[model samples]
Target: MRTAEQVTFGGSGLNRAAQIRGDAAALAQAMADPAARCLPMWRGKPLLRGDGLDALGLIPMDHPVLAAGLGKAIRAPVFLGLEEDGAPRFAHDLSRWEPEELDYGALGSFVDRSEQRHPDLPEDMAFAELRRVMTALSPRDAELAATAKAIIGWHATHRFCARCGVETVIGHAGWQRDCPDCGGHHFPRTDPVVIMLITHGDAVLMGRSPGWPEGMYSLLAGFVEPGETLEAAVRREVMEEAGVPVGAVSYLASQPWPFPASLMFGCAGEALAREITIDPVEIEDAIWVSRADMMTAFAGEHPTIKPARRGAIAHFLLQNWLADTLN
Candidate 1:
């Protein structure tokens, strides 16, 4: 797995200043510093700049959009980290501000092409869905955007303490939530998911969900249940979904998939048998695609099989497999 970190959202060496997360005075100084910049997000979308939406729209802390009552802030900004130049980075949720002429239908689709532009922001800047533009961003921007989305999404969902049903307050510079009533502490959560590339001879296992677009298929994946190892999850998922027993499982690479919050563990496994008996409840359909056909699909020439979305771990693993670089 030499190229493991080379995966889209894994390799960026962003210096997440963890030490300052719990330091109040240090956090204040960093926030007040003139070099601090904030990345504004709206409804899980990060503001992207340029005509191609290839860059993050990081604005100054004192920018007009951040002014009180002008552009609403859902909550205080969460400290992201310091840049290579020592400037502080933070994520601001402007989800409270509603954009005009918003396309409600395209907001949460599998392929949301809609982009939201705030009237107060420049024309070149608009909040674009992260999945739609993840590959276009630089490695550093991808990492930062992913981190911000995961953390902010966590805060949005976990506003109450599980221990006492009391409302929790943001703490640790957005890294933690504290229950004042019960003195309970909760941290951001990242669920582990195993997405495996199962192979039998020269073919691979592929499946499609019920709601996915026609002909769209990807590697079989499932959340790693409690007390289950990555290899065990891969074997169990493949067996349950496609009735294919897997052996000789090995790690390949990983990606930070922040659709909400997930860390995808990409693995490779050898199929014990090729006979397919798909579980209808777990998947709509399952098929064994030969390497040649897979190449055709990747080239967008296959008549009935569409490749996985680019920038996703499934695509990364399949691309490496086709390139003979899984080692």
Candidate 2:
């Protein structure tokens, strides 16, 4: 399990400057430093370079691309963390100024599928989806992108205070929202989810959601309910989704899945029974694949089922399981 951090979006050791977030003067000092860098995002796509999906583009604070994207608007920057050299880094959401006439390609119903354009940036500076290329990114880059996306997405959805229904303003270096009326302070939230790798002797249980591409399967996952432990969540999810009883659940690894801010807790579960009674609502299909069949799937030689995403925790765990490297 020590290889846990090696999973995509897991092991970035960014020194999150938590102590200075509330210090306005310290924040200003960091921002004014020459080494200060800012990452830009349009819609939800982050600006990245290079030919592969793993590339992330973090420009200097004085970059012209940002000025062209947002004009002179002084939006609050999210202070992600500091680099190993102590240079401060921040992220700005430049999704406010997208041209109305560009094609964004195909998209999901709830996604911001439109890619933005800027007069100052080259064509290769386009923002792209994080899920498609998270594995290709350096760990720090992935963490920064995930942090920015999650905080920005939170600000977008939670503009008002739940306590008194008052509009809240960003504060605490974009980590908190303050309600002027009720003295309420709100911080960003990271929801907990448990994704299970269930084993039954030689086979592993995998499930397919209703809308996933045909033959695509992955570890069964579900959000943790109030007051549920990680072990309990794994057991509950496996039983609820696949009607398979589980025992002795153990943690393996974790990942920051910022498809709008989630911490995926990867766990191994010993299934008490192999028979699966699929929950029609939770998943469309449930099947157990023998270790040999999974090897074929991973090698792209399987006739039907495709492998889990290469960098995702599911695939990481599966690969290790096959290699007997789950320590």
Candidate 3:
């Protein structure tokens, strides 16, 4: 897994500045400083700039959109970290704003291509879905966008303490939630998932969910259950979905998939047999695709199969496998 960190959203080595998260005095000074910048997120979409929407639209603390309260702030801005020049970065949740003629249908779909614009913001800046533009963004911007989306999503869903069901308040510079009633502490969640590259000789196992677009296939994957190891999860998931026994599972790479907060563990496994007895309830289809057919699919020349989405870890693994670089 030499190219593990090269995966999209793998990491950008951003200075997290964790030492000052609990320092009230320092946090206040940083918030008020002119060097402070914020990336406004609307409904899980990050504000992006540039003609190709490749850069984060970070607004200054005193920007009119933020100062004039154009879009309501759902919560206090979360401190992201420090930039290369030691400037503080923050994420603001502005999901309350309702844009004109917003396509409600596309807001939260399998692939949300809808973009929203705030009237006061510059024309080049708009809230765009991260999945659509993740590869176009710089590694630093991609990491920041994923971090912002995951943290804000956690806050949105986990507003109450699990211990007492009492409302919690943001603390630790947006990295934690504090419960006033029971003194309970809660942190952001990142679910562990295993995406396997199961193969038998020159063929790789692929499956498609029930509602996926026609011909779309990807490696078998499932969430890691409690008390289950990564290797065990890979074996169990493939067996459950495709009825294929897997052996010799090994770690390949990882990606911070912030589609509502998930960490994808890419693992390689050797399939025990080629026979695929798909469980209809778990997967709609399962098949062993040969290396030659996989290359044709990746090239968009196969009529019956479409490759996995480009930015996903599945595609990354498949690309490396085809290039013989999955070591």
**Looking at model 3, which ten-residue stretch has the lowest summed lDDT?**
66-75
TM-score per candidate, in order? Answer: 0.97, 0.94, 0.97
CA lDDT scores, all candidates in order? 0.90, 0.83, 0.90
Worst 10 residues of 2 by lDDT: 106-115
Q: Which residue segments of model 1 deviate by more than 4 Å?
A: 67-74
**Candidates 1 and 2 compared by TM-score, better number:** 1
Please give, for residues 74-110, the per-residue lDDT of candidate 3 as tens digits: 3578899998998999988887777888998898677
Query: What lDDT score goes with residue 305 in model 2?
Result: 93
Q: Evaluate model 2: give its TM-score.
A: 0.94
What TM value does model 3 have?
0.97
- Model 2, 158-203: lDDT tens digits are 8899999998888889888899999999888899999998999989
Q: Candidate 2: where are CA atoms >4 Å away?
A: 64-74, 103-105, 109-115
Judged by whole-model lDDT over C-alpha atoms, candidate 1 comes out at 0.90
Clashing pairs in 3: none
Q: How many angstroms is residue 248 displaced in model 1 relative to the true structure, after the best TM-score fit?
A: 1.1
